[model samples]
Target: MSSSKLARMAHVCVLALAALSWGAKTVTYDFNVTWVTANPDGLLERKVVGINGQWPLPVIEVDKGDRLVVNVHNGLGDRGCSIHFHGMFQNGTNEMDGPSMVTQCPILPGSSMTYNFTVNQNGTYWYHCHTDYCYPDGYRQALIVHDSDAYFAHDYDEEFTITVSDWYHELVEDLSTEFMSLYNPTGAEPIPSSFLLNDTINTSIPVKPNSTYLFRLINHGAFVGQYFYIEDHSFEIVEIDGVYTEPTEADMLYISVAQRYAILLKTKDTIDKNYAIVTVADSTLLDKIPSDLQLNNTNWLEYNKNAPHPQAIVNVSDSTDLHPYDDLSLVPYDHMPLLPEPDLEINVTVYMKNLMTGYNYAFLNNITYTAPKVPTLYTVMSSGDLADNPEIYGDFTHSVVLNHNDVVQLVLNNGDTGSHPFHLHGHQFQVIDRSPPYGPGFYDYLNGDPVPYDPNNHTAFPRTPARRDTVVLPPHGYFVIRFVADNPGVWVFHCHIDWHLSSGLAMLMIEAPRQIQERVTIPQEHYDVCRAAGVAFEGNAAANTKDFLDLSGQRSQPGWIPDGFTVHGIVALAFSVLSAICGILSIVIYGMADVKNKQDSVVPLDNPNEVVVEQNATGQTKT
Candidate 1:
């Protein structure tokens, strides 16, 4: 071949390789979570956990195939925190999946930890602290992952993320204790004082005439489901829970807690006319909300920015507040073409009862889920007891282990008096079917028995099923969901309502434990996290491992900054997983990879106020 012809062929090969590998962007964020007082609704000053000193935290926006690396520095005094990225299928990076006491120990106070994961998929999601009642204290943020494969491009010119939440006057710290106490008589969850759009009672969205805008909506509330609509605009739903569905139109929609929707708003020629954005609390499920509190709110969708903001012209109606819409009509763009018959089925019954201590709580399978004293991941890995002896974890932990590659089906039969919004981490599942509140509310039993969630029935579900990470389980009803046990790690399947979660209405899906133990190597930094949090990993069984990590030499004392400030300490460790998809930038981490036993290490500091222990680079630690 001639020299020129050889060079041209080489150029063509380089171009082809470039086309094969393009979208691999790594996104980095520095988030500092601290306790501050902010009145989002402008009514009362309540202490809230804010990210980077902002109440609603920051909206995370990124394109698909981007790596998400977040440094969560918890500055809350004496409060341990963990954040769960709501619906990410944390493939192969289960350590980055943040569910406190499930995946890893809580990030200790005055300590920073890095969460590195990849967003290979696209959709609307949210991030919130998964520990205790921190989310109700305003530790939530909207996460949007964009892609080029959107089918609704023709209907929208631009996009906006709007969050609707139920706002309360009192701090969650003040109310959660009473709500879960044994002495509480009323047994009613605390009600919200107001409802907010984008963290404000009055939200004004300016729009142009003859333009289409995609409004990415998120229900970031804790207690109540919301029904929202504009007075004059009829929007078409294009996506639900980060999955695009075939375009469907509705006058009003009810969104459950932690649910997301992408609606295309087609602006009309009603020039200079302002429409009311009616937001009302659908309290039909709850029998008790403080009568004095207001539940109806009015936001604005204005065509003219100069027009004075108008009050709500439409009535706060309960038209679509009956129940969540049927997912059978909504078609998911990409998913398993046909629902598979489950290899394993679980009948999870939700109950309401007073415990032995007289505290009212919601129960799954007659047992309320409790936070494990140890991070279940470490427990499973170190002891190898999850598969052999799950009974050791007991009923409170509710850790269910499944073998690899089993198709799992869950039947949620609601035995409680109120509805719940259930969410699963890791993967989205197909909503197989649901029963009406008494056989479609007709004389249907006259024809046959009210058949609901029977495993023997084959024709119960629609041919095509709805795929989502969250679904509303109505009271006195049932819901069926199916998913494959592919991701090998511990994932949370729980109620998204903050109150219910605090009340122990949550369980763990320890998928493919044997495979997880064989393929996945628990990093030393994860054990260091438990060491910093003073949580014991190996409980009953003896294991061959170093007790603690002694990095280098000992330093004199501990140091901490107050109120949203960053801290560098022995627990300030970062790790990097070098995979083909993305990489983590590990900055100034000492004793992260190497493991050694600490001679005089005390039990992990349960109190953040404990004396600061320091370690030098010589593998020696000192207090």
Candidate 2:
């Protein structure tokens, strides 16, 4: 055998022995969440969420089968916060899967909560604030799960994690006021002020010649999806969103918000020159691009310190011109076959419409997601046999109860004129079909009505489809995904865009509530924080313990606008018309009075057409 093959075998053996030596252990972190100043893009400095008095929060690293615990204390004193491990299948520890008002209440100012769970799955994932409008202010970081038994672990010498995000100059709270206001009728997302690479710009990552490196790429931005490429280099895709996929060669990748990709890159043999790593923001997603806002950023892969590092030369007129390899073409490494005919199929259409308040809001089949008084998981735990009833979770939440171990097929049609990255909380799903595939034809339906999926008339589904936790739904197109409801938890399916999510583009999946109750238990710390935040831990959606069906005081979205003029609209129109008439009448009266006064003062001459004015003191003929 060749020496290279022997070396690879030796490496694999070493990793296997290391894995045996380092068994599962508990990893704990004490985080004091506070505000700190940072200027990642070098243009503006602003307050950002920091852990333990540091910005660019630490990346959490752990091995498979290890128990991870994080104790969080909210010290911002104004904002509530919670951390959601992005792609974890929390399994029996459903309460540890964090999402404000979905599984647990937000950790309010001065309150504390602990997230404790085991990491059974291995690949790339992240952790970020799940509270409403909280993560954009630098509250996110990458979470890596190291696996010695991975299919391609022996192929790389070292690994690196790089995060790309769209940074904003203003805080999310300030931006949200204008984002959800009547002034923003079209629900246009706030444009990012700058794009960041590893939370900073113009940096270098050192590398050696002729070495293989595993680069894990994460798009932790709030709104924009970015196209990533290494100039003059090609990488092999190995994993996506915590699911290991068979190696596929690609030169460029488009990563949407909250999505991840791991690629293996082999460096060139010579170290004379350095190369640029480029990330270009998707201009199609931006409503308006600012001249000062740089759409593309360049970082370097340094081969030698003495070599001249240069900026990347972009060759495309637009980001869309750079066609990335289609992720749907990938096949999983394990080759999990396509699931059987779904036991339940959910069909929902995305819509953006103006409510009675004149503000645009997102909806799924005419239902905007509204949070219940009690956390949905709490409602499920407290309610006994009625937990199986979806009605108990309230209408506004758009709750759907799933049976244990049932195959669920979800068909999402985009009626709106924008792309949305939909993410499921607890499970990675197989993407079966998508319309207008990811190349030049992605925007084919932008000018027309949405195309809903017709089960009988569509492209053939893949036998072993690619699995991912987040999938992007195209503009006015549709996507179909399926997964088995094996994990019993209150998972959320929502758009990853913070603006869209805050506008009610989300829904709840109450999977196996009976099993959830039997297997999961809420810690006292969770209850304490909920009580401190004035949230109910028991009862139905409306906090009515007496009657699970009573939803009289439940919170709801703003009322919808009628087809034509509404009552308030009619009253305002009449008031405006009356005011205009009175102003016009006053102007006419003033003009007539002035003319009558002039007639009274003028002296008439013998000719009817002529008139005389007052004579001067000198008494000359004044006519």
Candidate 3:
């Protein structure tokens, strides 16, 4: 039997086993996170983070109600790791949310951390390493929560989890150094070397002639968003970011990083020909497109073994030329109405600025997020009555305290020129309003200043708004989202672009802190891992156990550059001026000395037309 066939049989067996238990049961995965080499793009072989010594880490599958226990042993010897189950509500299990220094310390090399949580949600989701640019190294894969009870489950004959990613020839560590350097003053994101489908180039998925197939498409890349489509075929969008949407027909979709979509594609009735599955990377997001880099990748739907599989003929002058269906127009399948007037509104504008070090950093308003010395969740668990105080989490963490069950509205204004896909942990929020809707006009704001959302002067919001964990904030535009703060945990709201995220484009929402204190408990293994990693398990952001308010030695982002002149800037300027003066003085002295030597050596000539030549330095004389 072929390895692919055996793999399919194994997947079926797991699904059958999961189905056998109607009631909720535990699904355990023992992952030994290690380094493995792979050349997915065929251009270069590089080290990647894999599970159980396997590249393209295993896809975690479980039923909707099953409890998932991922016991991760960080065998990557050189790096720390943590797993964030993207789009999981996590509810009372905030520690399991898995952002290092936010919920728990990183599972350091040679340490173990078990993520034990209930899979209460359904639809497509993913799991990835949330520690310091780790997922880009290949520590991510689709995490499917099987729902036999889905509304459209009976509509599709079969399903496939397809992942589209932007590939890089270099590792993240090297790229990060170049990205966060003085050379990258504008914070131009590194362009990808290639785009991939199912982690490889030119792959094919065999299909039946006239079958309805559910394709769970995930953009698990680090930086670029991708426009996805199938030639001569259109798909019905059924879900976005795990939220079931009313089936809307779309010929193409623009899936940003960390975003997901579930589409029902009906195959062509005739099996004589094959169709190309095309994914075009959003070239507008890149600062420069390398001549050698491929912006588009084509896989296929193989209907016949002998049919000619041809490459897709891309006609777009730019990726934006291909219009994608606006996700903001999608209505949730549940038809959940917008919540009542928000009890609290948090308005933040995204900014990109160079700090004192002259390296560009991303920010929310005037603050850039910096991880605290102690994990924010640990601080919440440790601070007796001060858990509700955002100060305990430190100033640089950009912490916001929220009342339990209060309707929270978040207005995100993009001050930067680039579009950012913002993702929220713990809850899927309703996208209430956005300007310059997702089409040809999406880039309209690039010609002028950013347009902030005006609550009173905007189009009426959808009665039943789209609810998703991730939404793209248009370039130089704004978006408003609302959700009930019912999930008590320290959830992060941040841009999904890994580069931006690494540069501090994130903030923590401490929702129902008092409830979090009462509901959540740190597992002993987590504490053990903290000890093994030499991280503080109980304390404030500064690790001060005595006084939560005294955040004296907490981690902080680099201070902003002051107007006019800073002391360091002035000193640097003075040094530069002095060096210039010295260089000029040396040149002048040499030129004057040369002139004097020539004048001293010259003898009077007998005739006016005659000239005297003399050599002095080498002790040679001429007349």
Candidate 4:
């Protein structure tokens, strides 16, 4: 073909490709989850209704700028429901904040609300009901927004979403119709012995022999931390909580509630065989691991003994295009930057008590049992000097006080049997350290005399510092986190549990140096109208109205600067001819002194003719 014809053909192909992959295509998904009675099993159950009947809904995807309108029809006739998109910035759209009763009225039973918002962020974020615990199962789903740039896109042979959830057989409503029942005196309904990984379906993703697959793991389970591992393969974690991390290989990871992780795996095993994707309690963590962990062992020892090396449940196809959203990683929001040194340390205690018995009510600190009323060593130190001073214990509060500009170092202790997923609002934090009660032992210290962790040459990674928004505080374990108290609003910091929060397990965090309340601008002459309507104003009321005050050009803060000595104004007036001359003289004097010192050190290069002249070819000595 002639060169011109070849060029024309190439142009046509380029245009065709561009047309096929031009702008992002918009997508919207519909879902429904409802409470149902369980048979024979003697427990309450919830099944996903609309899309694929699964709890915690499906993984829905959209590209940046895609207009998404999700209409959640609350079918749980018991109470109202609202879906809050956690960690999502709706560009200050209050409606998108999804406050069940505050931002907008909740979707009452037999009614539905359309949540219209643009997908503007690319990271891991989720949507869950923001109402009472009773109506929870129906209102949870994973919403993923893809990055705009194509280079960051991922490629995988196969992909599947792993949604881990904790189940309770009793309708949260049966426990207590009143929302307060979540924390009331009655014991919580029996929590399931085993958690579900992906709606209780035997997890099996088929891949061709020697092919790689991707797993998008999302943890929205209320209580415990989840650790997932493939039966035979160590995976590469490429993304975390929806943000891509610097890729690293690990056998497993600890996933707290409301967080997500994405891992890639390459299997050398063949297709059409069965393999187990095992999930176990991160029981080794400081906190209590569930006693009864159900592993998928249908065929048991026999299958393990003679099963082919590369096992697969189904024939995997070429999935190179499945990881459409892989390259999208966690990009920092403008407000998030490397934090400055923290100025405050808050050590909050987690406790468990048998409401019926006073004996069981105890405090947890230093991996031992203590009376619940007593304070920790840090608390005593903070209160005052004497260790056993009555005054110190009398007025002492466990909470850490913080000023607005103060950076905060929050230490969370999970001393109870149940794990707590701690989340901080208005800011993300960096995880600095974690120490399980057992330290370097197989069992927790509660079992007595645990192995000590070594200070050096230890493979166990501690203090693996990284930025994170949510962290699972394992039972009988502790974590240290640091963040700046920058965002001034009343931010809620608590376990992301509808039940735990309502039970007084939550506390208020006050950011001091309260934001200065800006002066309200009232329109001029409006006050007269208000007075006519029986409203009164002080001092030239009518003139003080917004429009009048603005029109009069009153200084926003009249006393901000003393009458004639404005900071910038004085500085500008001082830079006159005299000041300029003085500045020039200072520079000249400094330069001359430097030159004289250099000449004095030279010793006049012995004999001018034989002088080692440090000069340019032009014979001009250069400095």
Candidate 5:
């Protein structure tokens, strides 16, 4: 072999050694937070949390049923903190719901909480700080809960845990506090200077030719929605929210905040080719926009800078030498059983309007931010009232009407200046379309009609159709989702961001249809009281009449009503017949008048008297 070939081999050998050391063991671990300066190499210095002095805490992999403990030691001297596990259902037990003060008390400074919960699920999941006012860069980690059979299921030749985060060179605390204190803020809160995909300050993924690799992807960015994909080659989605599906394929997958996805990919055999996984701004994901920005027609980038979008590329080396291991960690979907499906569709749209300020604004369809009311206004007010008012100045987001048994085709259309992760209450949806003309914030600039119809290009996310609680809709693009109206009751659907939902991005979905509601029996005393009080039993007349007849029938025969109620039925029939006759006579009279007018009109002029004016050379007209 030549010297250059030997050098290349040596370089690859060094990388292999690094990966081996990195991949040696996967176990559950705890981390204590420590404050560190962000933009250590950036122009604007900012502060963030470091895990045991590392920027990112190590990936934790634990088996199912294993009791996991996460001791989050709050190192920041000024702020209290807690961790919220995204997408983990712990039997509705509030003990595991790590809200800073509501579900559980905050872990104050110099203190920590040992959050214990069973690893009941097996898919992509994440953990992050739930403390308010902490910026997006404060603290977060990826927690991969492996299935019980994960070890013996498939032997992956190569596996990578690639995480994408939005990092800025500014203090999150200061930014969030400042924005909240503003009388009327315009655009989004400021973002950090850089975006990191897989720990690279600014880099892409490099792939070995003809080799496959498993990528366990996570989106822990505080608020931004991300799109994860591999250019050219498709990504086979194996799991989402830490649940395995029947291995679905897609060109790209969008990940909302607090959501995770795992994918398998095999690099192309051809040499010198590069594939890119990108996150552009997604307008479909935003809650609402300001009116002034809309007036000025602000572009997506000018409004929101740190949209959680990061991209990596797999580069194929063109040398004659090719890697022998063609298999990536992605297990082949050889003989998987078919899976069940969802039953409805919920359509979502992300739009923005310019507020009359120097700053721009956003909304998830129609919801915006607000402070939690004292005595909890939601306790006394109706759900409808809470949905109509905005605690902040943003657009409407929860503008959906759903009825039970209505199989939904939830389509999310991005009409805003930025991207948003459109999440639902009780289900996940199939992604049906994504067209391109990517805007500045990594949002897709695709068109869509208002109706809940699926576009043709996009495919379903893996394990999604099973019962997704959340799905990300790219900006400027629309997503088509189908779910069953299974859960009856008032459910909330909105952006997954705690602040966004708290603002006004949430609304209630009453699943009771008209017919089902009519079955509710009213007390006779209450009905009599309503009648005496002049309550018009307008819409309920049909049911009231039917009940009256049934009571009369019960007093008489099984097949006939009593003589007393029979006269009422006859009177109603006579009124109906008379009304029909009157309507018909009215129509006949109108028709006759139209015909008479047509007959009485004079003959139309074949040609009116034509007047011709000829202009002479001296500007004189001759007719």
Candidate 6:
């Protein structure tokens, strides 16, 4: 090829590539949250919340750094709804966070709200309703953000997601009634009638021989942790939550509630043989149902159904009898233990007992948490009372107010008999340390103050800790995590198990309340939803207090007008800021549109060595 021809080809390729990647900006999604009754596991039928009328909701996929705008219209008959983006760090847009009673008000019945945030991190994630105890229903769905810099980048042929869960037949309302009643006051959670994968008992996945595939496993269950394994296939895990990890080869993995794992699967040369992709409820920590009630959920991995296979091909087992590793013990790829020197440390010991409520309630920091009448976010921002006097903030809600950009080290010790899967919203925390299962371990527990344990203990600190959003706290074991409170919001750090969260195993992280107030403008739509919820609860007088706290008559301050500022003056100033923001956004959008519309004449690729060749591309030969 001549020099001029080669130069022209390169120029054309760049132009075409630029054209193809144009207009790839933030995505906006409109979702309808409606109550759709369906049987997902074929065990029983009941009303379950569905997104866009689809059971198990729908998978939301995006790229890293894309601004996500999701508008949700709640159509549940008498309940409120809030969709918490499970692993997203809402950063500056704290009001857009959806944790009810923690961040913002829930979208009331027949109401709509918009969640806008930038997906700055990437990997397997999920979203679900955070209001009430309806998380066990079919409301949760997978949310995946693709990152180009993900570990094991060039090793995979294709990628897919698998969601596994325990299925219940009764609605949350009915279950809560029995669960909290005197008959079952010890709060023995209802055993699942079945287990499911992607809303089905058995899901099918097609595979090609000798190819590398990425399988992202999302454990979206509300109660039980799941054990996952593929028959005769060993895989390498590269990512957990939203952070990539050093590749760890394993045969089986333990996936707890609200957790995710990304692994690379290499297919064997056997073509016509089918393999089992099995997921069972971790029987060690959950109620065991009969073997016939669809307990062991499974999927299939095979190459071709039509082609006949030789007898030499190995067979797979349908029995769920594999031992899964403790995933909390894994390490991150960039493992350096000394990275997180915390500015503040908080120690909590999880305990469950029959408390103020008739049911068995879980506690953290010796406080059985309860949602306040006003949202912690609203309470902190509107009045700045929590910031001015944080001493008054220490109530049943168990709040830990942090300064702006404060590095925090949180230690959790599970004092309960059962294991708990804990998850934190708005941040992916670096896991620094954990205690051994049942032995004389590193931490000197005998010499310490129990219950509200001592936080200043340097006991088995890691140099290169694994970072994830959700972590498992083994029974009588401890786990420590470090995170920086850079994002200002009322974030929820709670046990991911629905029963525990509903039973008050949660704490509020009031991060930089004053900074959040200064940065985020409280939208009028949020105020509308708050008013509507109170009104709906008052009129019917039948809705549970846990659903929405009654905010009638006990008025603290009227209107959010600041001192020395008139209502009209505040409105005028707000409108001016809104107008400026709209103008800037319009300019940005128009500029992007103009770039997309720009026409460029391109010289064709007329010779060999000019075509773009990728490893997976077809029609390859020596020219």
User: Which candidate ranks first by lDDT, i.e. highest?
Assistant: 2
lDDT of 1 at 448: 45
Can you give the lDDT of residue 355 in candidate 1? 46
| Model 6, span 3-34: residue lDDT tens | 99999999999999778555446788888888
Candidate models: Cα lDDT each: 0.74, 0.93, 0.91, 0.48, 0.48, 0.74
Off by over 4 Å in 6: 1-24, 306-322, 334-337, 385-388, 392-394, 437-459, 535-623
lDDT of 2 by residue, 1-623 (tens): 99999999999999997786578889999999999999998899999999999999999999999999999999999989999999999999989988999899999999999999999999999999999999999999999999999999999999999999999999999999999875677788999999999999998999999999999999999999999999899999999999999999999999999999999999999989999999999998998988898998899999987899999999889887878888999999999999999999999999988787777889999999999999999999999999999999998999999999999999999998899999999999999999978888888898898898999999999999999999999999999999999999999999999899989999999999999999999999999999999999999999999999999899999887777875446446656777899999999999999999999877656898766555777986555
Q: Candidate 4 at 307: error in angstroms?
A: 9.0
- TM per prediction: 0.80, 0.89, 0.89, 0.56, 0.52, 0.77
User: How accurate locally is residue 168 in candidate 6, as Cα lDDT from 0 to 100?
Assistant: 81
Error of 1 at 219 (Å): 0.8
RMSD of each: 18.4, 9.8, 9.5, 32.9, 23.9, 27.3
Off by over 4 Å in 3: 1-21, 565-623
lDDT (C-alpha) at residue 389 in model 6: 43
For model 6, give the RMSD to the true fold: 27.3
Q: Model 3 residue 200 lDDT?
A: 89
TM-score of 2: 0.89
Better of 1 and 3 by lDDT: 3
**lDDT per residue (tens digit) for residues 1-623 in model 3:** 99999999999999997786568889999999999999998889999998999989899999998999999999999989999999999988998999999999999889988899998889999999999988998988999998888899999999999999988888899999999986667788888888888888999999998899999999999999999999999999999999888899999999999999999999988988999999899888998988998887889989996899999999999887889999999999999998899999999999998887778899999888898988899998989898877888898999999999999999999999999999999999999999879998999997799999988799998899999999999999999999999999999999999999999999999999999989998999999988998999888999999888898998889976779875456446656877999999999999999999989866767898986776778899876
- Report residue 560 deviation for candidate 5 (angstroms): 58
